[model samples]
Target: MHVPDWLDAARQRELLEACRRWARPPAGLRTVRTPGGGTMTARQVCLGWHWYPYAYARTVADGDGAPVKPFPAWLGELGRRAVTDALGPEAAREAAYDIALINFYDADARMGLHRDADEKSAAPVVSLSLGDTCVFRFGNTETRTRPWTDVELRSGDLFVFGGPSRFAYHGVPRVHAGTAPGDELGLTGRLNVTLRVSGLPGPAPGGGRSGPRA
Candidate 1:
């Protein structure tokens, strides 16, 4: 489901500012390297659970090995509202979401076709967009090739995929450069924040990592 302009301008600006803070330190934004030995152009940072090739961890085991950041309470609240809005009150009632994967995209950054299959939870994945617009390629569960839909995702848009489409393949194939109201938001790129339920056993590492910038 795609809910256009779900965040409004004020919320977009606020989330962008929060992204800046999360992009620093030991567990800060870093490039993702796939198991096949290729690096993703879009840099990413995670809260509650750090993700690697195809697994989740409490530390940036693929980058700095620092303890992952905490899943902020405010984010949890926001996610609840999002899920409630997307899947109704009943679905949101039992949702205890605790993982967020935030990605920062430059003009040239593009995510290839892929599927989000690391989570054990069947709950929906809530996605929020900020900054520049992009062509989101939402594909099928059977393959990365065609029979897919290309949706233009702009700033403040909310996209939720779950139920039958929960494990479907999806990606950002192109980010229209400079399309963002950069002068107003002070961001020249794109930011995609996805809230998910990890459903992993054990709590995240109780420690935090802070120090020199990444």
Candidate 2:
């Protein structure tokens, strides 16, 4: 579990721009209320298919009603590059990182401690943070007890967890207001995108995850 401080500003800007485009409604971004009665905006660009914003499985129809944003292959490559850079190119090839869950955090946003256990793949989750700073709470998989680590995450920081760290309970306790890069960055709020590969039975195709099994 290591946080890379070498992610230069230019790279950060590149990812930020990509997120802004992905955050566009229809193309990917959509707002929904959380189980706790809070709200969260999600951008599902890739990772094959997913029932984003919703925790259930359903078929998503595409029509004039709601435009669906196709997942960009380039972003998949970007995720690969991130893994290769952090865990070496060879390891990156073996890593499964296809779906990215871009979450927008408001001033009052907070994520309770939980494990990313939905996906069957054991590959590490590559999380990128842009705009604003927040305290990340990392806990163990066995229990939400002691041995928890709270770390500060700022813009352009990359957090990767694999091997023994995968399946660990982690979340954002809070997001500091007015911490984003501003208008120039095209990002007005905090953006956290987590790239993952969903290892469903068959090869998952593009389109909304709310659809019948192919």
Candidate 3:
């Protein structure tokens, strides 16, 4: 479901500023290379647990050796509230969300159809959109093809998918360029922050390889 205008102007400004800070250094936003060797157009930063091509680690395994930024408690609270608003109080009480993937999209950026299968938990995923609007394709679990729904996600919208839709395939086909929420917000692109529960037994042992920046 999509909840439009879920966050007021002040809240949007606050989160946008926070995102700018989170997009720096160590675990900051960077283009991601898939296992296929191609790079994603949208830059991403992970909190709580760092996400590489196919695994989750405590540190930026593919970038600097520094630990990923800690997930803010307030963000978790926001996620809870979002879930409660989209689903119900029972879900909010049961969800122990611990991970967040923040993706920034420029005018030409787009995401391919994919599933959030890396997570071990069956908890619902809460997605919050800020800035430019986008055509979000929600597909079935079996494939990335047809029989999907296209939803236009505008700034301050909240979308929660769980239960039967937890493992469904989804992607951003396109982002409306130059459609940000005005200059007052100090943003020029789209910011999508998705909250999930990693449900990992524990953080991976031994630090990741210290590699050059991607």
In order, the Cα lDDT scores of the candidates are 0.86, 0.65, 0.86
Per-model TM values vs. the true structure: 0.93, 0.78, 0.93
Q: Deviation in angstroms for 157 in model 3?
A: 0.5
Task: Evaluate residue 27 in candidate 1 and report its C-alpha lDDT on the 0 to 100 scale.
Answer: 99
Error of 3 at 15 (Å): 0.6
Residue-level lDDT of model 2, residues 1-214, one tens digit each, is 4565535667677776766766555545555555677654322343345444433232333212343344456656666777777777775776645566777787877777878877778877888888888888999989877689998888877787777888999988888777766664555557787877666565444534322111
What does candidate 1's lDDT look like per residue over 1-214, in tens digits?
Answer: 8888888777787888878888998899999998899999999999999988899998899999998988776776677788788778877776677898999999999998888888889888899999999999998989998889999999989898877898889999899999997677788889999998888998654423232121
TM-score result, candidate 2: 0.78
RMSD of 1: 4.2
- Supply the TM-score for candidate 1: 0.93
Q: Superposing all C-alpha atoms, what RMSD in Å does each candidate have to the true structure?
A: 4.2, 6.0, 6.0
Off by over 4 Å in 2: 33-47, 53-68, 181-186, 204-214
Clash count, one per candidate? 0, 8, 0
lDDT at residue 111 of model 2 (Cα atoms)? 79
